[model samples]
Target: MTSSRLAHEHDEHVCPRFHRAIELVGKRWNGAVIRALMDRPRRFGEILEAVPDLHDRLLSERLKELESEQIVQRRVYPETPVRIEYALTQRGRDLERILAEVERWAHRWLPQPSKS
Candidate 1:
Protein backbone atom coordinates (compact mmCIF):
# COMPACT_ATOMS: atom_id res chain seq x y z
CA MET A 1 0.00 0.00 0.00
CA THR A 2 1.14 3.57 -0.59
CA SER A 3 2.33 5.74 2.35
CA SER A 4 -0.84 7.88 2.26
CA ARG A 5 -3.02 4.73 2.24
CA LEU A 6 -0.95 3.30 5.10
CA ALA A 7 -1.43 6.48 7.09
CA HIS A 8 -5.17 6.39 6.50
CA GLU A 9 -5.32 2.74 7.50
CA HIS A 10 -3.43 3.48 10.71
CA ASP A 11 -5.83 6.28 11.55
CA GLU A 12 -8.73 3.85 11.21
CA HIS A 13 -7.52 1.97 14.27
CA VAL A 14 -9.03 2.90 17.65
CA CYS A 15 -7.02 5.27 19.81
CA PRO A 16 -6.64 4.45 23.51
CA ARG A 17 -7.09 8.04 24.61
CA PHE A 18 -10.16 8.43 22.40
CA HIS A 19 -11.59 5.22 23.76
CA ARG A 20 -11.02 6.40 27.32
CA ALA A 21 -12.70 9.71 26.59
CA ILE A 22 -15.74 7.98 25.06
CA GLU A 23 -16.00 5.68 28.06
CA LEU A 24 -15.95 8.65 30.37
CA VAL A 25 -18.43 10.73 28.41
CA GLY A 26 -20.68 7.89 27.31
CA LYS A 27 -20.97 6.11 30.63
CA ARG A 28 -24.57 5.79 31.76
CA TRP A 29 -25.97 9.28 32.42
CA ASN A 30 -22.56 10.97 32.50
CA GLY A 31 -23.29 12.90 29.35
CA ALA A 32 -26.70 13.97 30.60
CA VAL A 33 -25.33 15.01 33.97
CA ILE A 34 -22.54 17.01 32.37
CA ARG A 35 -24.91 18.66 29.91
CA ALA A 36 -27.17 19.66 32.77
CA LEU A 37 -24.27 21.30 34.58
CA MET A 38 -23.22 23.15 31.44
CA ASP A 39 -25.68 25.94 32.28
CA ARG A 40 -24.29 26.78 35.73
CA PRO A 41 -23.46 25.46 39.15
CA ARG A 42 -26.28 23.54 40.78
CA ARG A 43 -27.10 21.94 44.06
CA PHE A 44 -27.39 18.19 44.27
CA GLY A 45 -31.14 18.38 44.37
CA GLU A 46 -31.19 20.76 41.43
CA ILE A 47 -29.11 18.41 39.31
CA LEU A 48 -31.38 15.57 40.26
CA GLU A 49 -34.34 17.60 39.11
CA ALA A 50 -32.68 18.49 35.84
CA VAL A 51 -31.96 14.88 34.97
CA PRO A 52 -35.02 12.67 34.81
CA ASP A 53 -35.03 9.20 36.38
CA LEU A 54 -31.64 9.67 38.05
CA HIS A 55 -31.73 8.23 41.53
CA ASP A 56 -30.08 10.10 44.40
CA ARG A 57 -27.69 7.27 45.14
CA LEU A 58 -26.57 7.00 41.51
CA LEU A 59 -26.23 10.76 41.20
CA SER A 60 -24.00 10.76 44.24
CA GLU A 61 -21.87 8.04 42.72
CA ARG A 62 -21.64 9.77 39.35
CA LEU A 63 -20.71 13.08 40.97
CA LYS A 64 -17.97 11.42 42.95
CA GLU A 65 -16.61 9.87 39.79
CA LEU A 66 -16.61 13.18 38.00
CA GLU A 67 -14.98 14.77 41.00
CA SER A 68 -12.20 12.20 40.91
CA GLU A 69 -11.69 12.95 37.24
CA GLN A 70 -11.40 16.69 38.00
CA ILE A 71 -14.34 17.27 35.67
CA VAL A 72 -16.59 18.40 38.46
CA GLN A 73 -15.83 20.51 41.50
CA ARG A 74 -17.80 20.38 44.73
CA ARG A 75 -18.10 23.51 46.82
CA VAL A 76 -19.27 23.93 50.36
CA TYR A 77 -21.08 26.97 51.63
CA PRO A 78 -21.24 27.93 55.25
CA GLU A 79 -24.92 27.88 55.92
CA THR A 80 -27.35 26.52 58.43
CA PRO A 81 -27.62 23.38 56.37
CA VAL A 82 -24.09 23.41 54.96
CA ARG A 83 -25.07 23.71 51.36
CA ILE A 84 -23.04 21.95 48.70
CA GLU A 85 -22.97 22.65 44.98
CA TYR A 86 -21.43 21.00 41.92
CA ALA A 87 -19.97 22.85 38.97
CA LEU A 88 -17.94 21.84 35.95
CA THR A 89 -14.26 22.71 36.12
CA GLN A 90 -12.36 24.20 33.21
CA ARG A 91 -11.58 20.71 32.01
CA GLY A 92 -15.24 19.84 32.02
CA ARG A 93 -16.31 23.10 30.38
CA ASP A 94 -13.82 22.37 27.64
CA LEU A 95 -16.15 19.55 26.67
CA GLU A 96 -18.92 22.01 25.84
CA ARG A 97 -18.09 22.37 22.16
CA ILE A 98 -17.52 18.66 21.77
CA LEU A 99 -20.71 17.78 23.60
CA ALA A 100 -22.64 20.38 21.65
CA GLU A 101 -21.42 18.86 18.41
CA VAL A 102 -22.55 15.49 19.62
CA GLU A 103 -25.88 16.98 20.48
CA ARG A 104 -26.23 18.39 17.01
CA TRP A 105 -25.25 15.14 15.41
CA ALA A 106 -27.71 13.25 17.54
CA HIS A 107 -30.48 15.59 16.60
CA ARG A 108 -29.71 15.15 12.96
CA TRP A 109 -29.10 11.43 12.81
CA LEU A 110 -30.38 9.70 15.91
CA PRO A 111 -33.92 8.62 16.47
CA GLN A 112 -35.92 10.95 18.62
CA PRO A 113 -36.85 9.77 22.08
CA SER A 114 -40.45 8.62 22.21
CA LYS A 115 -42.86 10.78 24.13
CA SER A 116 -44.63 8.62 26.62
Candidate 2:
Protein backbone atom coordinates (compact mmCIF):
# COMPACT_ATOMS: atom_id res chain seq x y z
CA MET A 1 0.00 0.00 0.00
CA THR A 2 1.17 3.53 -0.81
CA SER A 3 2.21 5.86 2.08
CA SER A 4 -0.09 8.66 0.90
CA ARG A 5 -3.03 6.22 0.81
CA LEU A 6 -2.21 5.04 4.36
CA ALA A 7 -1.99 8.65 5.55
CA HIS A 8 -5.30 9.51 3.99
CA GLU A 9 -6.93 6.45 5.54
CA HIS A 10 -5.54 7.25 8.95
CA ASP A 11 -6.79 10.84 8.77
CA GLU A 12 -10.20 9.66 7.67
CA HIS A 13 -10.38 7.29 10.62
CA VAL A 14 -8.92 9.49 13.35
CA CYS A 15 -9.41 13.16 12.54
CA PRO A 16 -13.14 13.50 13.28
CA ARG A 17 -12.95 11.77 16.64
CA PHE A 18 -9.82 13.72 17.57
CA HIS A 19 -11.32 17.02 16.49
CA ARG A 20 -14.61 16.43 18.27
CA ALA A 21 -12.95 15.39 21.53
CA ILE A 22 -10.62 18.38 21.43
CA GLU A 23 -13.45 20.74 20.56
CA LEU A 24 -15.36 19.60 23.65
CA VAL A 25 -12.58 19.32 26.25
CA GLY A 26 -10.39 22.06 24.81
CA LYS A 27 -13.00 24.77 25.35
CA ARG A 28 -12.09 27.54 27.74
CA TRP A 29 -12.22 26.54 31.43
CA ASN A 30 -13.23 22.97 30.61
CA GLY A 31 -9.83 21.48 31.32
CA ALA A 32 -9.33 23.54 34.43
CA VAL A 33 -12.77 22.58 35.70
CA ILE A 34 -11.99 18.92 35.12
CA ARG A 35 -8.70 19.27 36.92
CA ALA A 36 -10.44 20.87 39.87
CA LEU A 37 -12.88 18.00 40.13
CA MET A 38 -10.18 15.37 39.77
CA ASP A 39 -9.39 15.39 43.47
CA ARG A 40 -12.98 15.38 44.68
CA PRO A 41 -16.33 17.11 44.34
CA ARG A 42 -16.42 20.89 44.61
CA ARG A 43 -18.96 23.63 45.07
CA PHE A 44 -19.31 26.32 42.44
CA GLY A 45 -17.27 28.72 44.48
CA GLU A 46 -14.56 26.14 44.96
CA ILE A 47 -14.34 25.47 41.25
CA LEU A 48 -14.04 29.17 40.59
CA GLU A 49 -11.32 29.43 43.19
CA ALA A 50 -9.48 26.36 41.86
CA VAL A 51 -9.31 27.86 38.42
CA PRO A 52 -7.58 31.18 38.72
CA ASP A 53 -9.09 34.21 36.99
CA LEU A 54 -12.15 32.30 35.77
CA HIS A 55 -15.25 34.49 35.63
CA ASP A 56 -18.44 33.45 37.37
CA ARG A 57 -20.54 33.55 34.20
CA LEU A 58 -17.98 31.61 32.21
CA LEU A 59 -17.66 29.00 34.92
CA SER A 60 -21.40 28.51 35.08
CA GLU A 61 -21.60 28.04 31.34
CA ARG A 62 -18.66 25.69 31.26
CA LEU A 63 -20.06 23.59 34.09
CA LYS A 64 -23.37 23.29 32.32
CA GLU A 65 -21.62 22.29 29.12
CA LEU A 66 -19.56 19.68 30.91
CA GLU A 67 -22.64 18.31 32.60
CA SER A 68 -24.39 18.00 29.29
CA GLU A 69 -21.38 16.25 27.84
CA GLN A 70 -21.61 13.75 30.72
CA ILE A 71 -18.11 14.68 31.80
CA VAL A 72 -19.26 16.47 34.95
CA GLN A 73 -22.10 15.52 37.24
CA ARG A 74 -24.05 18.08 39.26
CA ARG A 75 -25.68 17.36 42.60
CA VAL A 76 -27.82 19.63 44.72
CA TYR A 77 -28.16 19.16 48.43
CA PRO A 78 -31.53 19.94 49.93
CA GLU A 79 -30.79 22.56 52.52
CA THR A 80 -31.52 26.16 53.42
CA PRO A 81 -28.72 27.37 51.23
CA VAL A 82 -29.37 24.57 48.69
CA ARG A 83 -25.75 23.73 48.08
CA ILE A 84 -24.68 22.57 44.64
CA GLU A 85 -21.69 20.34 44.14
CA TYR A 86 -20.00 19.26 40.94
CA ALA A 87 -18.06 16.07 40.46
CA LEU A 88 -16.48 14.23 37.61
CA THR A 89 -18.32 11.31 36.11
CA GLN A 90 -16.54 8.08 35.25
CA ARG A 91 -16.07 9.36 31.73
CA GLY A 92 -14.48 12.49 33.07
CA ARG A 93 -12.25 10.57 35.44
CA ASP A 94 -10.96 8.67 32.46
CA LEU A 95 -9.46 11.90 31.15
CA GLU A 96 -7.22 12.33 34.17
CA ARG A 97 -4.47 10.17 32.69
CA ILE A 98 -4.77 11.99 29.39
CA LEU A 99 -4.47 15.34 31.14
CA ALA A 100 -1.42 14.16 33.04
CA GLU A 101 0.22 13.15 29.79
CA VAL A 102 -0.64 16.50 28.30
CA GLU A 103 0.88 18.18 31.31
CA ARG A 104 4.07 16.20 30.87
CA TRP A 105 4.23 17.15 27.19
CA ALA A 106 3.68 20.81 28.00
CA HIS A 107 6.39 20.75 30.63
CA ARG A 108 8.77 19.26 28.10
CA TRP A 109 7.95 21.27 24.98
CA LEU A 110 6.38 24.49 26.24
CA PRO A 111 8.60 27.22 27.54
CA GLN A 112 7.69 28.79 30.86
CA PRO A 113 7.55 32.57 31.18
CA SER A 114 10.01 34.15 33.58
CA LYS A 115 8.60 35.29 36.87
CA SER A 116 9.54 38.93 36.97
Candidate 3:
Protein backbone atom coordinates (compact mmCIF):
# COMPACT_ATOMS: atom_id res chain seq x y z
CA MET A 1 0.00 0.00 0.00
CA THR A 2 1.17 3.55 -0.83
CA SER A 3 2.25 5.74 2.12
CA SER A 4 0.08 8.68 0.95
CA ARG A 5 -2.94 6.32 0.59
CA LEU A 6 -2.37 5.06 4.14
CA ALA A 7 -2.25 8.66 5.42
CA HIS A 8 -5.49 9.44 3.54
CA GLU A 9 -7.17 6.43 5.16
CA HIS A 10 -6.21 7.76 8.60
CA ASP A 11 -7.43 11.35 8.00
CA GLU A 12 -9.40 12.81 10.86
CA HIS A 13 -13.13 12.26 10.52
CA VAL A 14 -15.51 15.21 10.70
CA CYS A 15 -18.34 14.94 13.18
CA PRO A 16 -21.84 15.24 11.72
CA ARG A 17 -22.97 17.58 14.47
CA PHE A 18 -19.94 19.80 13.97
CA HIS A 19 -20.55 19.87 10.23
CA ARG A 20 -24.17 20.89 10.81
CA ALA A 21 -22.97 23.59 13.17
CA ILE A 22 -20.61 24.99 10.60
CA GLU A 23 -23.41 25.04 8.04
CA LEU A 24 -25.64 26.89 10.47
CA VAL A 25 -23.19 29.54 11.65
CA GLY A 26 -21.39 29.89 8.33
CA LYS A 27 -24.60 30.82 6.55
CA ARG A 28 -24.61 34.36 5.17
CA TRP A 29 -25.17 37.04 7.85
CA ASN A 30 -25.86 34.34 10.44
CA GLY A 31 -22.49 34.84 12.12
CA ALA A 32 -22.89 38.61 12.11
CA VAL A 33 -26.37 38.40 13.58
CA ILE A 34 -25.18 36.02 16.26
CA ARG A 35 -22.24 38.30 17.06
CA ALA A 36 -24.54 41.32 17.32
CA LEU A 37 -26.79 39.56 19.82
CA MET A 38 -23.79 38.33 21.79
CA ASP A 39 -23.45 41.85 23.14
CA ARG A 40 -26.97 41.88 24.60
CA PRO A 41 -30.58 41.63 23.67
CA ARG A 42 -31.58 44.02 20.91
CA ARG A 43 -34.55 45.21 18.95
CA PHE A 44 -34.94 44.38 15.27
CA GLY A 45 -33.79 47.82 14.24
CA GLU A 46 -30.80 47.65 16.52
CA ILE A 47 -29.66 44.42 14.92
CA LEU A 48 -30.03 45.98 11.51
CA GLU A 49 -27.86 48.90 12.50
CA ALA A 50 -25.29 46.65 14.13
CA VAL A 51 -24.81 44.77 10.89
CA PRO A 52 -24.33 47.30 8.13
CA ASP A 53 -25.12 46.17 4.55
CA LEU A 54 -27.64 43.70 5.99
CA HIS A 55 -31.01 44.04 4.34
CA ASP A 56 -34.32 44.13 6.22
CA ARG A 57 -35.74 41.06 4.50
CA LEU A 58 -32.58 39.07 5.03
CA LEU A 59 -32.43 39.98 8.68
CA SER A 60 -35.99 38.83 9.21
CA GLU A 61 -35.22 35.53 7.54
CA ARG A 62 -32.07 35.02 9.57
CA LEU A 63 -33.88 35.74 12.83
CA LYS A 64 -36.56 33.19 12.01
CA GLU A 65 -33.92 30.64 11.16
CA LEU A 66 -32.07 31.26 14.42
CA GLU A 67 -35.28 31.07 16.35
CA SER A 68 -36.13 27.74 14.76
CA GLU A 69 -32.66 26.48 15.59
CA GLN A 70 -33.29 27.43 19.24
CA ILE A 71 -30.21 29.57 19.24
CA VAL A 72 -32.05 32.87 19.69
CA GLN A 73 -34.94 33.76 21.90
CA ARG A 74 -37.47 36.28 20.70
CA ARG A 75 -39.58 37.99 23.30
CA VAL A 76 -42.65 40.03 22.58
CA TYR A 77 -43.90 42.75 24.85
CA PRO A 78 -47.62 43.28 24.67
CA GLU A 79 -48.19 46.99 24.85
CA THR A 80 -49.75 49.84 22.94
CA PRO A 81 -47.30 49.47 20.08
CA VAL A 82 -46.04 45.99 20.88
CA ARG A 83 -42.32 45.61 21.22
CA ILE A 84 -40.03 42.70 20.37
CA GLU A 85 -36.52 41.86 21.43
CA TYR A 86 -34.04 39.19 20.40
CA ALA A 87 -31.61 37.60 22.80
CA LEU A 88 -29.35 34.59 22.74
CA THR A 89 -30.54 31.49 24.51
CA GLN A 90 -28.11 29.48 26.60
CA ARG A 91 -27.47 27.33 23.55
CA GLY A 92 -26.65 30.43 21.59
CA ARG A 93 -24.60 31.99 24.34
CA ASP A 94 -22.58 28.77 24.41
CA LEU A 95 -21.18 29.87 21.07
CA GLU A 96 -19.52 32.95 22.53
CA ARG A 97 -16.19 31.25 23.19
CA ILE A 98 -16.11 29.68 19.75
CA LEU A 99 -16.92 32.98 18.11
CA ALA A 100 -14.32 34.76 20.19
CA GLU A 101 -11.71 32.29 19.10
CA VAL A 102 -12.72 32.84 15.49
CA GLU A 103 -12.42 36.57 16.08
CA ARG A 104 -8.94 36.17 17.46
CA TRP A 105 -7.91 33.97 14.56
CA ALA A 106 -9.29 36.47 12.09
CA HIS A 107 -7.46 39.32 13.72
CA ARG A 108 -4.22 37.41 13.46
CA TRP A 109 -4.60 35.99 9.96
CA LEU A 110 -7.22 37.98 8.11
CA PRO A 111 -6.57 41.33 6.49
CA GLN A 112 -8.49 44.42 7.52
CA PRO A 113 -11.20 45.63 5.23
CA SER A 114 -10.20 48.43 2.86
CA LYS A 115 -12.22 51.58 3.32
CA SER A 116 -13.92 52.63 0.17
Candidate 4:
Protein backbone atom coordinates (compact mmCIF):
# COMPACT_ATOMS: atom_id res chain seq x y z
CA MET A 1 0.00 0.00 0.00
CA THR A 2 2.98 2.36 0.51
CA SER A 3 4.05 4.65 -2.39
CA SER A 4 7.58 3.21 -2.56
CA ARG A 5 6.19 -0.31 -2.68
CA LEU A 6 3.80 0.65 -5.44
CA ALA A 7 6.64 2.16 -7.48
CA HIS A 8 8.76 -0.94 -6.92
CA GLU A 9 5.97 -3.17 -8.15
CA HIS A 10 5.43 -0.99 -11.18
CA ASP A 11 9.13 -1.06 -12.01
CA GLU A 12 9.24 -4.80 -11.75
CA HIS A 13 6.67 -4.97 -14.51
CA VAL A 14 8.14 -2.24 -16.70
CA CYS A 15 11.90 -2.48 -16.32
CA PRO A 16 12.59 -5.52 -18.46
CA ARG A 17 11.01 -4.11 -21.58
CA PHE A 18 12.29 -0.65 -20.79
CA HIS A 19 15.83 -1.79 -20.15
CA ARG A 20 15.95 -3.95 -23.25
CA ALA A 21 14.76 -1.07 -25.38
CA ILE A 22 17.27 1.28 -23.78
CA GLU A 23 20.06 -1.21 -24.34
CA LEU A 24 19.29 -1.20 -28.04
CA VAL A 25 18.61 2.47 -28.74
CA GLY A 26 19.87 4.37 -25.70
CA LYS A 27 23.51 3.85 -26.44
CA ARG A 28 25.26 7.08 -27.40
CA TRP A 29 24.15 8.41 -30.81
CA ASN A 30 22.12 5.29 -31.56
CA GLY A 31 18.82 7.15 -31.46
CA ALA A 32 20.24 9.97 -33.57
CA VAL A 33 21.51 7.52 -36.15
CA ILE A 34 18.08 5.91 -36.28
CA ARG A 35 16.48 9.30 -36.71
CA ALA A 36 18.88 10.19 -39.50
CA LEU A 37 17.88 7.09 -41.42
CA MET A 38 14.19 7.63 -40.78
CA ASP A 39 13.40 9.72 -43.87
CA ARG A 40 15.41 7.98 -46.55
CA PRO A 41 18.53 6.00 -47.25
CA ARG A 42 21.77 7.81 -46.51
CA ARG A 43 25.38 7.12 -47.23
CA PHE A 44 27.84 6.66 -44.31
CA GLY A 45 29.19 10.17 -44.57
CA GLU A 46 25.67 11.52 -44.72
CA ILE A 47 24.81 9.91 -41.42
CA LEU A 48 27.96 11.36 -39.87
CA GLU A 49 26.95 14.78 -41.11
CA ALA A 50 23.43 14.34 -39.79
CA VAL A 51 24.77 13.66 -36.29
CA PRO A 52 27.42 16.32 -36.17
CA ASP A 53 28.70 15.36 -32.75
CA LEU A 54 29.14 11.65 -33.38
CA HIS A 55 32.62 10.46 -34.24
CA ASP A 56 33.43 8.18 -37.15
CA ARG A 57 34.47 5.22 -34.97
CA LEU A 58 31.35 5.34 -32.84
CA LEU A 59 29.17 5.76 -35.92
CA SER A 60 30.67 2.74 -37.53
CA GLU A 61 30.03 0.65 -34.43
CA ARG A 62 26.46 1.88 -34.09
CA LEU A 63 25.71 1.13 -37.74
CA LYS A 64 26.97 -2.41 -37.34
CA GLU A 65 24.90 -2.84 -34.21
CA LEU A 66 21.77 -1.59 -36.01
CA GLU A 67 22.42 -3.90 -38.92
CA SER A 68 22.61 -6.86 -36.53
CA GLU A 69 19.34 -5.77 -34.91
CA GLN A 70 17.62 -5.98 -38.31
CA ILE A 71 16.28 -2.49 -37.79
CA VAL A 72 18.70 -1.16 -40.44
CA GLN A 73 19.84 -2.49 -43.74
CA ARG A 74 23.13 -1.87 -45.51
CA ARG A 75 22.93 -1.81 -49.26
CA VAL A 76 25.85 -1.93 -51.61
CA TYR A 77 25.42 -0.65 -55.13
CA PRO A 78 27.29 -2.62 -57.74
CA GLU A 79 28.54 0.52 -59.37
CA THR A 80 32.13 1.44 -60.19
CA PRO A 81 32.89 2.79 -56.75
CA VAL A 82 30.60 0.36 -54.84
CA ARG A 83 28.26 2.87 -53.34
CA ILE A 84 27.01 1.86 -49.90
CA GLU A 85 23.84 3.17 -48.31
CA TYR A 86 22.08 2.64 -45.02
CA ALA A 87 18.30 2.52 -44.76
CA LEU A 88 15.78 1.86 -42.07
CA THR A 89 14.06 -1.46 -42.36
CA GLN A 90 10.32 -1.85 -41.88
CA ARG A 91 10.98 -2.76 -38.27
CA GLY A 92 12.86 0.51 -37.82
CA ARG A 93 10.08 2.52 -39.43
CA ASP A 94 7.71 1.06 -36.85
CA LEU A 95 9.40 3.25 -34.22
CA GLU A 96 8.20 6.46 -35.90
CA ARG A 97 4.93 6.54 -33.97
CA ILE A 98 6.65 5.88 -30.70
CA LEU A 99 9.30 8.51 -31.39
CA ALA A 100 6.66 11.08 -32.29
CA GLU A 101 4.80 10.38 -29.08
CA VAL A 102 7.96 10.76 -27.06
CA GLU A 103 8.67 14.07 -28.74
CA ARG A 104 5.19 15.33 -27.93
CA TRP A 105 5.46 14.22 -24.33
CA ALA A 106 8.87 15.86 -23.92
CA HIS A 107 7.66 19.15 -25.31
CA ARG A 108 4.77 19.13 -22.86
CA TRP A 109 6.48 18.02 -19.66
CA LEU A 110 10.19 18.73 -20.09
CA PRO A 111 11.85 22.07 -19.35
CA GLN A 112 12.26 24.74 -22.02
CA PRO A 113 14.95 27.38 -22.15
CA SER A 114 13.98 31.03 -21.87
CA LYS A 115 14.64 33.23 -24.91
CA SER A 116 16.26 36.06 -23.10
Clashes of each: 0, 0, 0, 0
- Tens-digit lDDT string for candidate 2 (8-115): 989767668777999888887899899899999999999989998899999999998999999999999999979999999999999999998888998999999676
Candidate 1 regions exceeding 4 Å error are 1-12
- State which candidate, 2 or 4, has the greater lDDT: 2
Backbone clash total for model 4 is 0
Worst 10 residues of 4 by lDDT: 11-20
Query: Residue 29 error for model 4, in Å?
Result: 0.7
**Better model by TM-score, 1 or 4?**
1
As for lDDT, the candidate ahead, 1 or 2, is 1
Taking the tens digit of each residue's C-alpha lDDT, what string does model 4 give over 12-100? 78667777887787787888899898889999999999987799999999999999999899999999989999999998898878777
CA lDDT, every model vs. true structure: 0.95, 0.92, 0.95, 0.88
The ten-residue window of minimal lDDT in model 1 covers 6-15
Report the Cα lDDT for candidate 1.
0.95
Q: Give the per-residue lDDT digits (tens) of candidate 1, residues 1-116.
A: 79998689678997688789999999998999999999999999999999999999999999999999999999999999799999999999999999999999999999989888
